[model samples]
Structure formats: C-alpha cells, structure tokens
Target: GAPPPPPARAGGWAGAGSPLLSPGEVRSKPMTVLQWEKLSMGKLAHTLWGDGGSDGGAKGAAGALEKLMEPGRAFEIDISALEGRFARPDPSARFRRAESDNSDRSTVGSADGGTPRARISLLEPKRSTSVGIVENKLRGALGGKPLRDAILEVDEALLTQDTLKMALSAVPTTAEQALLLAFQGEPSTLDRPEQLLRSLCGIPRLEGRILAMMFKAQLEPDMDELLQQVDSLKAACEAVQGSAELQALMQIVLHIGNALNAGTARGNAAGFRPSALLKLAEHKAADKKTTLLHYTVEVVQTNAPKVRRVTALLPTLAQASRVSLEELRAKSADLARGMDQVERELTALEEAAEKEEERREALHREAMEAWSAAKEQRDEARRRHREGRAAARASEGGGGGGGGGG
Candidate 1:
C-alpha cells in the first residue's frame, strides 16, 4: 500500500474539493508513486506544508496534515447586511424642511418659525467684511439713528464718491429686494448681512436717495468734460472766423480757381462755397502729378508767404473734427435728466424732513396742552378743599357760642 492513502480530511483539500484532482478521478487513475511525488512537489506540497515545503519527516507531515484537516471557513459577504451597517439617512433633510417652511411663510406674508432653517445672507460671510462693520459705517453716515430717520437726515455733501459707489454696489436687485421684503424671519436669527439689508428695506425711498447721491457725485466730472468739449469747439470756430491769414489763404484759392476756368462757362466766378476748397486736390495740372492745391501752395509761397501761416489752424480743426455734435447733444440731455432726478429726490427728502419736524412739533403741543389741563384741575380741587375747611370752622364757632348762651 502506498502509505495507505492519507485519511480523508474534514475540508477535503484546501477548504474545498481538491484543486488538482477529484477524489473519484484519483481512484480511477491510480497514479504511480512517481506521478504522486511529482504532483505533491507542486501545489499539493505547498497546500499540505503551509507554503514551506515539507521537512521530509513524519513529524512535519503530521503537523501539516493536522493544519489542513481543521474546519475551513468560507467568507461570504451579504450586501443587505452591509447596507444595514453602513447606510445613513440624508443629512440635509432638516434643511430642506426648514426651506419649505420659510417659503410658505413668505407666501403668507407672516413670520412663523415652524422649522429651524439655515441663516440666509446676501454676501459670503468668510469672504466679506463682517456685517457689523458695514452696519456701523452706515450708522455713522446716517447720523446714528434708526434707518427711517437716518435716511431722511442723509446729507449729499457729507457722502464721498467712494462711499456713494459702495452704496450703489450694495443696492439690492429687484429680485433680491423682493426676497428681503418677503423675509419674515426674526431679525436676531438672520445673518448680519441680511439684517442690514432688512433694516435698509424698512426705510422710505432708500433706493432714490442712493441713486441721487451717486448721480451728484458724478455730476462735477460730467460738467467739466462737457464744458471742455464746448470750449474746444468754440475755439475751433473762433480760429476759423477770426484768422486773417486763413481768410486770405481762402481768397487766394478762390482767385486761382477762377483764373484756371477762364474762357469757359465756369469763368468769372465771384465766389465759391467753402466745400470747394476740398476740390482743389481733385483738379490736376497739365502734368497730372501737380494738383490745383499743389499749384496754389507754390504760388502762395512765391508771392504771398505771410498768408501760409494758416497751417497753425490745423490742430484746432483736427480737435474740432473729433468732437461729435450728436454725442455732445446726447450727453447734455443725459446730464439734464440726471440733474432733474437729483433735484426731485432732494426736494422729496426735504419735504419728508419738514413733515417729520411738523409731526414732532404737533406731538409736543398736544403733550403741553394735556399737562396744562391736568394742572388746572389739580388747582381747582385744592381751592374747594380750603373753602370747605374755612366754612366748617365758622359753623363750629357759632355752635360753641350758642351752647354757652343756653
């Protein structure tokens, strides 16, 4: 017997049926000693010896066999078990609920905290300055009072251009304004930016005041530019109108043009339009290379050199050419509209301030009248008490005298 085939192991081989040959196949094949040794030297040897080839003795064989014969475990992963262990509910569920509640509240135009929501803000907290800083600056600018009162007291002269620009940037968009208006959340619960915006929203005519201030800040530069353009145009017109040299140059061109057309129907020309000066370049001389303008220049240089100084007007003409009449008109119209808007806003602000003053005065008067009435009533009660006391004393004296006489 070839070592009496090793007793059947609990797991058969390597935790399953033999990897090399099945039990039935081994019985049918009846492998020779050489074939078994060769097979054992490979996978079977490693499996039996636990990766260290057998130590070639009964003791080592017995130990490896004992190790292999032990009960084997198959690792099976149950996906459902994994899911139960690791799955988690959505973390944002509460946030979603709060948002829905806020939406409902907004629609109803009421503030009710059915669910706790994340704080909302117009600007990022980490990237922007704290809302407190912004609020403080605004408070300082608006006279450190309630927004409603501060807006009325805002002084255009006190606001710098940079401040106006910042205010313009912070001006809420229509949708943002609507959102702010709809917000019914507790002010303490809101982020600083939101709270500031909400306070601004409570003021009357806030947008108009900001826009008017911005326009006023820009008005000086706009007026200066407009005046500069006008001055440039005026200088150009004056140069053309008053320059004797330019006038003489034109006269020379006119005389030369008439002499060239002599004997033709175009001869004896007394005058030509100012536009005809441009045609001087179009009329070529007999050589074709020399233009009428070239000829006129040569004649002026040779005969009347003093009139050539008209070239000084070239720069003025160039500057005037760059000035677009239509653009100037458009700018002027825009400035006018801006000024009117500013005036209206200022007038409205003044009237609101006056009305606020009148209301304060009226309240003071009413308070004074009430105080006077209360004082008069108290004085009358004191006078009646004194009179009653005096009459009582007189009756007492009269009674005592009568009793004595009796």
Candidate 2:
C-alpha cells in the first residue's frame, strides 16, 4: 500500500506500521494548536499547501472541526496564515489532503530534491501564493519604472487615452456596462467609489460625462484645465440629459454661484438668482433621469428657504458688476430661517407704535397739572402782601406821611 511507506529510511524501523500502545490508537499526528479555526479549507490548502482545493482538503477539514475539540497543544499554521498577514481561502475537505501532501513534498524537495538551482526554480515567487508575485509581475511589465513615471503612465493610460476616448467612445465589453446602466439607470451609484468609476471610465450617458468631469475636478487639485473643461462639458450634459430635474439643479447652481461670486473676476456666481430662476429651476422633467435633478430637488425641499433665498439674491448680486458670486452668496444661507424671524420682529414694532403714542400723552398730562398748581400759589402770595400794606397804613394813620416826617 503506497509503496510500503518508502521502505523505512536508513536505521528507522518503519513499514507503514500504526503506532500503538497509547490510550487511543494515536491515529496520525495530534491536532495542531494553530489558528486552524480562522483559516478556511481553501485557505489552508492554498496558503498551507499547493496542489488544488477550493475549500481545505481532508486534513484541514478535520483540523477545522477538530481544533475546538482539541484542548492544548501548539499547532503551527502557514507562515502566511500568521496573525495580521494572510487571507483565508475557501475550505474543502477533498483538497486539503492534496495540498498538505504538496507542502510536505515542498519541504522534502528543498531539503533533498536536487541542486540549489532546482530549488530556486521550484520556489519562484510567481509560482507561490505571495502578493509579491503579482507586485513583481506588474513591476516587470513597467520595465523598472520610477514611482513618478508610474503615476504619469496612469494619468495618460487610465484617464486621457483609456477613458476620455476608448471607454467613452463605446459600450463596455464586460459586464461593467450592464452594471453601469443598472446603477446609472437608477441612483445607486452616486456614493459608491466603484459607481463613480463609470464616470471616470467615461461609460455613462453624455450628460454624465460632464458631471463626471466636474466630480473629477472636485477630487483632483490644481487641474485648472480640467475644471475649465467642466464648463463645456456642462453644456453637453445639459443637452443629453435635458430633463426638468437636471435643469432645476442647473438653475440653482448658477444662482448660488452668482450670489457667492457677486463681484469676483470669476463671474461664476452671477448667472442664476433665485427669483429670476426658481420657475426656471424645473424638477418636473418628462424624461425620468435620476441625477443632479433628484439630488437638487431633495436638497431644496430639505432647506427650502435657503434655495429660495439663493435664487432671489441672484439679481442683486449681479448688479455688483465685478464681484465674486461666491463671495455674495458665501454666507447667504447660514441663517435661512433667521430671515423669517427678522420679518416677524418688524411686524411687532409696527403694532407697538400705537401703544407707545398713548403712553406719551399720559406723561404730558401729568406735567401740565404740576405747572398750574405752581402758578396759583404765586398769585395768592401777591394778594396777601398788598393787603398787609393796607392794614398797616390804617393802624399807624400815617403810613406814607410818617416816612416823610422822619
């Protein structure tokens, strides 16, 4: 059976004999205390051994289910499977044995198979399950490129040539196109980085291309050229996805830009003021496109007054002639609700004007009464003085003649 265990090497008395005399037949080796529990059968097979197995093979399967049953004993895992490193492959009992045997042979191969040259070929990095394998292969493709060159290559290949032209020119050959339509078809792709890939790849609708460019400009810095391209692209987007919803968003953006930009040289914010544009900010487009339209409508509803105020201020800011619309509208919406409170206060002041007039009349009446009392006292005092002079003259019988004789 299996060549009688290779005829018991040298002095070792082996003949596929089952070790006995132990309490329980001892079966193969005792279970390893490795984190066999963490790795899946496939991981055990791939990372631990080589051969083939989606799920780990027999040993891994036995070990996975048995690790918990095992109480104590150190079991070594694949170096890759060590804490913080490897991803566990899927598990399968059938493949575990084949992979384990492969690992054993690898050890044997290195130890005694042949020359160092043979071992090197056997242990080529590409042939192993190491991430370095692919990393090196990619480097090999670049022919020893520097990091900066690599980035430049990506900008050209991934951005300009690959997407702005190739991918943008036609539908995708992969399922990506279907997925794109499904996502862009609905609104599921906005937040996902992968979904944004369609725009980056230039696989979306015509208008989506401009939005994508805007988003790219937003994400990338100092790319003034690309940002400029966003303007022309905006026109294309408008023409392609020309629905009411998208139009409304467009109107809102222009007004907001104008309000904020008021007098800036950019002149970006003067185009759309709220009053001149709300009716223009249509969300009732006949074509059902889930885009900036739905997003704008939701934003306006959530912060209705802010949207209205931004639209209304558009015209006034435009009058500034050379201000940044961004500057004018910069803080216009921070207190959207406060504008309401200001109107309320003005109304209260108007109503209080009548009550205030009544209080003034009452104060004037009190002052007039005090003045009349003072005048009456002065007149009475004068009358008493005159009478006193007359009485004195009668008693003395010579009031005016006495003074002349003296």
Candidate 3:
C-alpha cells in the first residue's frame, strides 16, 4: 500500500513551503511525504551547519528531514505504550501496588528497561517565614475591625494568577500529578475555565469548601475581637449618655458660654448643642497659652473632680467612631453566608461519599473536620451578634432616657 498518510507532523510543524503556522494552526494541517522530505533535508542541512533561526523553524525542518531520511522504510509508534516506557507510573497505581505487594519499593521500568521510579521517598516540605510577619500584623490589626472587609480590600491582589501558580508549584509532585489527573477530564459541574485552572493547579474539586475552612481559621479570632470592640464602644457611648457628672459639667459649660456672650445677641441661650464641644479648643485666651476647653477642664476638676471619670468613658466613643456600624454588620452577614455555603458543600460531599463503593474514609474525615470548624465559627459569630445587639439596645435605651430628661 502507498505510504500511510504522511505521519502526523511531530513537534507540531508544517512544511517550510507553507506559511509558518502558529501552534494552534499547526495541529489542524498535515504535510505530504514529498513535502515532508524536502523540509526534512533542509532541516538536516541547517542542523549540520546552523539553523540560524528560531527553535520552532529548526524543529519543523527536522521533522520533514526525518521523513526524507527514512523513505520507503515504514515507521510507526504505539503512543499508548509510550507511557510505560517514558512516563512515570500512575501514582494511584503505585499506591495500589504498594498495598498489595506489601512492599514500599513498587517499581516501574524505564525506556532502558531499568527500574528507575522505584522506592521514591516522600520528602518533607521546607518551612519558610516569608509571610509570618505579615500574618501576625494582619491578625493584630483585625483586633479592632471586621476581617472579611479587610481581607477583601487586598484579596484580589493577594490571590492573583501568579500567586496561585506559585502555590501550585510548591505542592509535592505526586500529589500535584494526582490532583491534576482527577480534574483533567471535563468537569460535569464546574465551569470549563475554572475546571481547567483547578486541573492545572492541583486544587481539589471541593477546594471552595476547603478554602472556607481556611478562611474561618484566619478570621474567627478577628470576628470575636471585633464583636467585643463593638460591645465596648456601645457600653462607652451608654456610659457617656448616662453620666450625671458629665451632664453637670456640660451644664456648667453652657452657663459659662452664655455669661461670656451676655451682652451679645447670641447671649442667654436655653441650651448649647453638643457640637459646641469641638469649638472649645479653638477659643484661645488673650495670651494664647490656654484654650477654652482647658479652662473648662480646670473649673470642673476644681469643683467636681469626680466628673473627670468621663475621660475614661471616651474610649468607647473613640473606638466606635473608627468603625462604620453598617459596614461591620455587612461583614458579619457575609461571614454567615460563607459558613452557610461551606455547610451546604459539606452536605453534598457527604451524600456523594455515602453512595460510593470505594473506601472514602479519608475524604470523609477531612470533610468532617472542615464541617466542625465551620459550624463552631458560625455558632461563635451568632453568639457575638446577639451580644452586640443587646449592648446596642442598652446604649439606645440609655440615650433615649437621657434625651427625654433634656
């Protein structure tokens, strides 16, 4: 029979006579034996002397030259069998063999008929402190604010494609290869691009579930502390609102202000607004050595030293001022949503694992741990929300009573 369809171009190139095709275009077309022979001869001549060109051009020349040099001689290769000779043994197959043979040195023969991929030892990963200081700083900063919002502010930059690629590169080769194989097939559930990425990166199919657990680990403490800070701020605001000594000092300030403006049109006011407090520092004496607030502080300290306790109560308002209640609640709600999603995914995994014939005990155990941690975080967040609400209600009631008295 006539030479079998010219062997599909190897190294993905077409004849030099044709346009230099891109990688995507190269696979779609094939060259005839005569064309391949001419290209091949040119490639051999170039290689022997110098290609003096790009690598792809040189390879194309080589592939064509290969056909010319072997004219009339049949050449064939069994690609399926190539794996045994060139590729590493499937990790799962090695694991199964290791189990059955009860031997750790499960071997696979190489192209040279030598058992090269045998008794491969697993190595421990090296420890690095690249992000230790940053992690600590993040945890510390989260002491006073919502963590999710803070993380969201920079998560886009931190979790970029480059970062994921670096993370994938760090995974062990066997684990990485196994993960890639598991996701290599078309995904029945995930988007094509996302599945492709997960396949390439060695990320588990249920990584969203795993990632939620990871996030909870990092954020739960911050959630707890933020709730406490919110409560403290509410308590402080309530303290400021309910302090009779503070109210008395305010009355003195109003009286002094009205007396100073006695002859002016703005004199003898029924009450001074709270905003007048901010203007106290702006009012300077003739010598400019003291502010009106300093004088007021002296007067209060001299006549009612007990009222000085108001300064200690100011921290609650100060802390509260730094946080937006609306944004904080939104972050809390987001955490609750994330936990709910994790719970749902865990439920789905459990259901799927139940019907499987294989022993998925390890997968089940991992799912359970993630589920437990997520549930605990959800419970803690719910409890803190309750406490924050009660504190807020108390603060509101105290302010309402104080306002009613005024």
RMSD of each predicted structure: 45.3, 38.7, 45.8
Off by over 4 Å in 1: 1-158, 173-178, 188-193, 244-307, 318-322, 380-406
Tens digit per residue, CA lDDT, model 1, 103-204: 566343677644433344654543134444555676677565544443456656556666555555555556656876787767777665666666676566
TM-score of every prediction relative to native: 0.46, 0.19, 0.34
lDDT of the candidates, in the order given: 0.55, 0.34, 0.46
The Cα error of candidate 2 at residue 103, in Å, is 29
Q: Which candidate order results from sorting by lDDT in descending order?
A: 1, 3, 2
Task: Give the candidates in order of TM-score, highest first.
Answer: 1, 3, 2
* lDDT of candidate model 3 versus the reference: 0.46
Write candidate 3's Cα lDDT for 165-214 as tens digits.
33323333555345545654455454322233333343333345445554
- The number of clashing residue pairs in model 3 is 2
Q: What lDDT is reached at residue 51 by model 1? A: 32
lDDT of 2 at 78: 20
Residue 314 in candidate 3 has what lDDT? Answer: 67
- What would the per-residue lDDT of candidate 2 be over residues 140-200, giving only the tens digit for each residue? 4445543223332334433432233322332233464455455534445242323333433
Q: How many Å off is the CA of 396 in candidate 3?
A: 99
Candidate 1 accuracy as TM-score: 0.46
Report backbone clashes per prediction. 0, 45, 2
